[model samples]
Target: MKNVYLDNNATTMIAPEVIEAMLPFFKDLWGNPSSMHYFGGQTGKHISTAREKVAALIGAEPSEIVFTSCGTESNNMAIRGSVEATGSQTKVITSRVEHPAVLGPCQQLKNKGHALTEIGVNSSGQLNMADLRQELTGEPTMVSLMWANNETGVISPIDEIAALVKEFGGIMHTDAVQAVGKLRIDVKKTPVDLLSLSGHKLHAPKGIGALYVRKGTRLNPFLIGGHQEGGRRGGTENVPYIIGLGVACDLAAKNMDKEIKNVAKLRDKLENKLLATCPNTSVNGDRANRLPNTTNISFQFIEGEAILYHLSDIGIAASSGSACTSGALEPSHVIRAMGVPFTAAHGSIRFSLSRYNTTEEINYVIEKMPAIVKKLRAISPFV
Candidate 1:
């Protein structure tokens, strides 16, 4: 069976171009960038060029971009580093719907005596900025909200939120892991203090990512050892993955304009078809201003896991918010925190598209998905 990959938000297939870019680093150019020897120094040149590429894509200075293992490390480094640098503050503020990368580290800060304020989101999954404003007034704090939500594809008003933090003299961070390739990001245009991105989400290989720290921001190091990343992060670099990420960034910058329109049209078409044919259905996020390539839907009468299994059997790759948190009884925290009805929470499915997805794939999934949902609903006692 020809598989259709609709789970781009979780991860993506590595692009051929990215893989080609990385191949040389693994075999031919293998050397420690920190070493001053001639063999190692050649690797430094390639790493520097890659850094500039990553920096250019995000509109940040090459000096400000620090290479890290993945988005989670970048987020942890940013949040922990900022609070440690600003010893005067013991409070952190973030939303209820951030990816675990952002929220998990902040939750850890509580053990160190840092107070955490968890703000709520509306049913549409947009952060409650008004509540955020109320929280910011109380103390010196750092605020982290994802640029786009992972489960629902809801694009938060990060520019406005960043400005609100500035008014209160607070540092702002945003996890742009899902938003990097799907949306246009210019860090210079937005004065956020920190932002995070992952390579795997953008057709690059996993195990490499970057953190953007605005100039003049003081950050404590996450991994302390060598002077790599200008002492921001330490340890040996993953040269092959970094090279792939650089090439991926270059490609994303090139094709972002046309791909955005094409994918958004396809995403909307798939979503509309499902909602029209399926009964008791609803979308999970704000209808307007979501990631152009993602659609999350809920089928009320059945569990999300059963729907996903049925779809998978037909070569359709999709994810259920409920099943992703398997081994645990609780439903998706994101959906639950948004105040979605408990009845619909177990039924949420996320279908994320990438630039590589074609019209044929969309049509194929649309042809197969309705019947799958029907089959699952028939057996579901909830129906």
Candidate 2:
């Protein structure tokens, strides 16, 4: 009964190297970065080093990086901060399939009298650029779209979107939490105004994230307590986790090419095998432009929660896009946005792989998943 975890999108196992890099900060060098003494100075230097590492991973300047609690905070800061900085504008634009981090803040703003335009996606889960162009007709305060879909792993044309936002005189931001390590990110190349990433999504410990602000992007501070994070964010930094995240980013930069090729091969093998073994199944999203290490498959006429329970019995971990697991009556917003049929949308399961995942683990899941699905469907009333 081996434990095979494929739910990297929810969180990932912290890498041993990252833990090793972080241990010293927790043990001997636990000083407030703002302290005036030598101990604080040493810790502060490490923070600066960590900042450089994170910035390098995304092709940003160290000055442009601002550490925050997690991806949610970063997203909020990027959305709310940019809008507030540009006081004259009153509109924010984003897509229908963004993670709740971005969507939640936008909805909150909409409730507070700000105009919010949520662009729709096609049946393939790709954004309708025409709709985006129409929304950008006005002087939008900001446009926040995700670089990748967490459930479907669909990669968006963020570089193109950023260019459009620039033309329309709107600030551009991307929640790149799921895309940061798995894909190549060069802020210089993309020219986005702001970007958010979580450390936990890339084999670093949780509770640490970063926001990248392009130089000269006017953004009001989201958290204003102290002068830390260059007066952009104000809190005692989570020193150890920040150091861990930096190591993880360095590791990601070094290993991304190999990880992409190997993980994609493993993911494709498992997905193809599962689809072949099951009936009335379909893959979600545009398979051609998806994250290399993810596959979302829909099992028609079955409940995803029931399937999850069956898989759990075998020590296999996966995530469901179904509304049943999300405490809702409707299916996944991502699947629904893509126009996935009601029959299939309720049963979509997301399997996200990591660099640590091996062919053996994928094969093990492929061997067991078909039987689990068959058993569940046999008892499903909808079938």
Candidate 3:
């Protein structure tokens, strides 16, 4: 049996080029970037170069980029930091479908006496701009939204939302972890005050991510110790992973155009075939505006975990929207937020592709998925 991994949104395989770029930092250039000695100074220069590379990937100035541990840290820094820095403004606005990273901080702030407004999405999983407009009527301290949803692959109208947030004078932040490599993101073009990205989503290692703080954005330090990351984030930098992230960003920039076409083609082929062959299947989210490499499909009347188990047995790796723990099934919050019927929500599966994925792999998945769905449906009482 061939191994097929289609869960790129959960995490991606590290690029070989990224590994190669990171090796020297671990063995030879092991000096701390914060040190003033010649050995450390050389390592510091490498860090600067990596900073430039990461900045270029998002069309941001090098000075605006602050390296952090991962997307979670970046998000916490943006939300927690901005709220603390802005003294009087207590209102924070966000969407119902944002990742835990963004939502967690917002909820935490709410517990600490800040006003929280969660804007809902339509049945199509598009943000309700009317609710957003209503929320923005009052002065909000911050607005944190995801650029693209992880489970649904629905791309938010961030440019428009950011403009609105700007007009309201609220500090805007976007969790761009899923959007950074798959989509073209130019902070210069978008007026978001802060954006967070995880390197692991783009074929870099898991321990690295960055936050872009637009010049003059008021933000308190999230992790304060050393003067690293220009006093925005403080700690000894993970040198090897930082180098790996830089290379990953460079590779992403070079291959982005090709990935936009090839990945989309393969994803569409897989999604179209599965929907056509499998009975009682529906595509989730706003299909017209989504990340090219993702498709979430719901096979009604069956448990998603059962389908995942069967796929695992066949050496085909996939993910379910339903969170199954201790034999209890909790449907995806994202799908539920989109108003997917209870029957379909329990059966939704997300298949996210990457640049490394091939047509053969996609075809193999398409051929096997229908039979798997059918087998599960036969035993499903809801059907």
Candidate 4:
């Protein structure tokens, strides 16, 4: 069985180059970045360099980048911290299709007496901008929306959304964990106040992430302790993972064009083949306005977990929805938000690709999927 990984949206394999960059930090540069000694200073300089590299990937300044433990922490820092800084009276707005990281924090805020509005999405999983516009009124607001849907790969119109938020004097935050490596983001052009990114979504190691806080954004610190991450996030830095993340960012910037072209080609090939060959199958989300390396398909009359089990047996990894919500038996909130029928909703599978995927690997999955779907449907009681 071939080892094909189509679960990049969950987490990616660390790049060899990123590993090489991190090795020296683990063995030689094992010093606290906060220390005043020479070894500490040397490690601290690399953290600064990593900060710059992470900022460069999204067209941000080095000073605006705040290192966090992962994307969830970044989301929490942006959502909870911004609300704290903006005062308890601020209303929170987000979409219904957001990852649990964004939605979870927003829900907590709601429980704490903050006014929370969840904007709905269209049948194609596109954000309802009109709804968002309506909600932007009536209070000083903070809008936290995902730049791209993790399950369906639907890209939000963030540039327009951010501009609208600014027009209403609202703070805008984006969970760009899936979008950072897949899309070209320039924070200056978009005018978003805050954005979140995770390292593992790209080719960097897990347990490292960053938040881009725009200059002059009044964000209260999420973690309170010693002054680390410019007094934003307080903790000892993960030096090796930070260095790995920086190298991964630099590599992503250089190869983005090729990644967009090659990965999309493979994604399209897989999506198109499965839709054509499998009966009662349909693609989800807005095909024209989605990420290049993602596809969500629903196979009617079958359960997604079963498909995944069979696919895993053949070494082809996929997902039913966000890995964060994988164990829940219910269909994903994302698919349910799009109003997909119960028959299709429970059967939806997401295949997210990466720069390392090859044509041969894609072809192998394409060849194997139709048969698996047919067999599953044969036993499916819904059929």
Candidate 5:
């Protein structure tokens, strides 16, 4: 059976260049970066170079980048650190469509008596900035939102949100895990105070991520007891994975244009053909503004997980918006946030692509998708 991978939003396969870049660090350069000995001092140099690579990817100073275990940790640090350092009961603003990394922290803060209000989005899963402005109340707070939604790939108005947050004297943060490789991000030029990214989202090995903290931002340590990362994040780093992430960043910068054009075209080809062939299928979110390699569709009168199973049998990878997969009782919070009909929400399917995906593979998915949905619908009681 031929296998296809269309779940890059979940996690991406590591690049060969990233793997090769980390191989030496695991063996010859195994010295701890914290030691003052010559061997260890040299290890710090490698770490610094990796920091520069990560920083360059997002247009931040090398000193502002702090390595972490994953995107979740980076997010937790950003939200919790800001709240802790400020020590104010000020409001924490976020959208209803945020990932668990951001929402989970916000929920915890809310439970602890902090005011956390979520701004609602429209039918297209975009934040209503006017609602956000009204909610601000001119109080000192931090607002966190993702740059692009993972399920729908809808790009948020971060620059606009940043400008709005700036008006209130509150800091702003963006979870850029899905947007980092697919879009250009310049922290300085964009005016976002903090941003989070995951290595696995951009061809780097898992277990390494970074948080971009602007200079003089009010941030407290998420983990204490180590002097590493200039005390921003504690404990010795995952040295090899850090190196891998740096290499991935460099590769992304080099190949961004080719990636955007090629992958976006492939995604569009598959998406349009799928809709044309499937009678009741409709796309979700704004067509004009989305990540280069993602498409969300709903097949009416069908269940998403069953459709996913049918596609899986034919070696097509996809995902459903069911609560079972999302750690919630309802359908995907994103689809729900968009106010999608419950009937349509149950049939939502996400197909996320990557630069490595080929036109032939996309065509293969399109060829198999209609029949798979049809087969699932036939057996589906809802249909």
Candidate 6:
């Protein structure tokens, strides 16, 4: 059977160029970046170069980037560290539709007596700016919001939100893991004090990510140990994966136009065809303001897991929700937060694409999905 992987949001296939860039580190330059020896120093220099490449991808200064294990680590570090730096009394503000990584840390803070306010989202998954403005009123706040929704690909008004946070004398952090490679991000213009990104989201290998800390941002270290990541994050660097992340970032920067144009074209074709062919189907989230490579659709009276299983059987991979939240036997928090009805919520499926996707692959999915939805809906009691 032909393999059509539509689950780029969960994790992407590693880019061939990234693999080529990383091989040298594992084979020949296998030295600790923190070591004082010549071999180690050489490896350390490449790490610095990697830092520059990562920074450049988001229009940040190289000194501001700190490497981490993944997006989850970056989010935890940004949220917890900012709260620590501010004090125990810091008010944490976030959206209801955020990834678990952001919500998990905020929940922990709430349990510890810190004030935590979860801003609500509209039916379209747009943030309620008025609610956020009201919550920004009391105490010194640290607002952690995602740049885009992972499930629905709904882009948040980050620039406006960041400006509001700053106006209220609050620190602003964004989980840009999904938005970084898919959308054009320039930290120089966005005014976000902190931003997180995972390398695997952009075709780099897993186990690599970065947090962008603005020059004056007061963030305490999340992991404490011997000086590494400029004493911001502890432990020895994973040099090979770091090198791969850097190369991936560089390629993403170069190919962003193609992602917006070609990948988006393929995604639109797939979405449009499925909608045209199927009955009782509707697209989720805002149609206009979203990532170019993602679409979430809900097929009424059918379960998303069933759709995924059938699609998988056909070698066409998709997702019911965030990979981090998979297997929970419930609708996605993101979908539920947006008030997607129980009928459609259980049936929501996310099809996230990538630059590597082709028109032919999109056509294949388009051809197969209507029948899958129909077959499953035929058995549903709700039907």
After superposition, candidate 2 runs with Cα above 4 Å error: none
The models' CA-based lDDT, in order, is: 0.89, 0.93, 0.91, 0.92, 0.89, 0.92
- Candidate 1 Cα outliers beyond 4 Å, as residue runs: 323-325
Residue pairs with clashing backbones, model 1: none
TM-score of 3: 0.98
lDDT of 3 by residue, 114-226 (tens): 99989999988999999998888646569999999999899999999999989988899999999999999999999999999999999999999999999999999998887
Q: Which 10 consecutive positions of candidate 6 have the poorest summed lDDT?
A: 321-330
What does candidate 4's lDDT look like per residue over 1-383, in tens digits? 69999999989999999999999998899999888899877999998999899999999999999988899999999999999898989999999999899999999999999999999999999999899988877478999999999999999999999999999999999999999988999998999999999999999998999999999999999999968888998889999999999999999999999899999999999999999999898999999999999999999888888899999999999998422337776789999899998888888899999999999999999999989998988897778
Residues 1-383, candidate 1, lDDT per residue (tens digit)?
Answer: 97899999999999999999899888888988778899888988888888898888888898999999999999999999999998845589988888888888999887788889899999999888789888887467888889999999999888898988888888888999999988899988887999999999999988989999999888899999888888888889888888888899989988999989999999999999999988899999997979998888988978888888888888889888884447668788899998988789889999999988899999998888888878887898878
User: Please, what are the lDDT tens digits per residue for candidate 5 over residues 194-273?
Assistant: 89999999999889999999999989999999988898888998899999999999999889999999999999999999
What are the models' TM-scores?
0.97, 0.98, 0.98, 0.98, 0.98, 0.98
* lDDT for position 168 in model 6: 84
Poorest lDDT segment (10 consecutive residues) of candidate 2: 133-142
TM-score, cand. 5 vs. native: 0.98
Q: Which ten residues in a row have the lowest lDDT in candidate 1?
A: 321-330
Model 3: residues >4 Å from true position, as ranges?
A: 325-329
Clashing pairs in 3: none
Report the Cα lDDT for candidate 1.
0.89
